[model samples]
Target: MARFCLPRDLYHGKGALAELKNLKGKKAMICVGGGSMKRFGFLQKAEEYLKEAGFEVQLYEGIEPDPSVETVMKGAAAMEAFQPDWIIAMGGGSPIDAAKAMWIKYE
Candidate 1:
């Protein structure tokens, strides 16, 4: 049988990213693409919130526009090493999609 898995909670809107502070986890791995999020300050804000929530945040930046298999492998390896309880993907669709694939690979 086919099965599905989804986040238990989903928050949106301008300050939605702030909700990261509420996540209960010891570690969080933030996946991002390029420097748009960083340039806009969203990336720093996300990290700060996660850190405020007592999570050890590790960043896996530069996920590229259309991530490659090698990139996925590297991200998976990083996830393995970091052993994060949560994976926070920021930026555009590329990073999110890459993170999703990395999530599957890590598991």
Candidate 2:
């Protein structure tokens, strides 16, 4: 059989973070930035969802805009320790973009 492992099984939009509820991972590392997700409480929702899914979820926040290479390395180090099967990025462009870089390093 071919070997292929996609990131996460599902991505729910609008309220996609809720999708974490169904994940089967033992751990999840969430990368976020600024305060939008927190202000709206999406970060809490995402964490709750992951926990509901039976995962030991943690967050790596304060990612800056146009994230730097240093930031990516630090995030990657965090993932190495968490050893999460899932990576949830919530917030603005900085978080998403930084999450992408972290993803590459994680793999």
Candidate 3:
């Protein structure tokens, strides 16, 4: 049998990032790509919101476009070390895709 997993809750639209403050978890790992999220202040806001939610958050930044094997391994290793209860993929498709791969590797 094939198994599929999905987020229990999904939030979007204006101020959706702020929804991080409502997540219940002890730790969260944020996976992000290049500087766009940071340049736009979304990254910082996410960190702040997660903190406000009482999560010990760690950032794994600079997930490159398309992502490479080494990047995935590095991200998986970080996830292993952090042992986060939640993995938040921020930024564009690259980051989210990379995070999915990392999750598989981490598991």
Candidates in order, TM-scores: namely 0.91, 0.84, 0.91
lDDT comparison, 2 vs 3, better candidate: 3
lDDT of 3 by residue, 1-107 (tens): 97868556555679899889988989999999999999999989999999999999999999999999999999999999999999999888899889889998888
Off by over 4 Å in 3: 1-10
Between candidates 2 and 3, name the one with more favorable TM-score.
3
lDDT of each: 0.90, 0.82, 0.91
Q: lDDT of candidate 3 vs native?
A: 0.91
lDDT of 1 at 78: 99
For residues 1-107, what per-residue lDDT tens digits would candidate 2 score against the true structure?
85544455435467677667877879889898887888988888888888888889889998988999999999999998889897888776688778878878787
Query: What does candidate 1's lDDT look like per residue over 1-107, in tens digits?
Result: 97658556545578899899889989999999999999999989999999999999999999999999999999999999999999988888898889889998898
Instruction: Give the Å error, residue 8, model 2.
Output: 8.9
Candidate 1, superposed: residue stretches over 4 Å from native: 1-10
After superposing candidate 2 on the true structure, give the runs of residues whose Cα lies further than 4 Å from its correct spot.
Answer: 1-12
Whole-model lDDT for model 2 versus the true structure?
Answer: 0.82
Measured over all alpha carbons after superposition, the RMSD of each candidate to the real structure, in angstroms, is 1.6, 3.6, 1.5
Provide the lDDT at 86 for model 2.
78
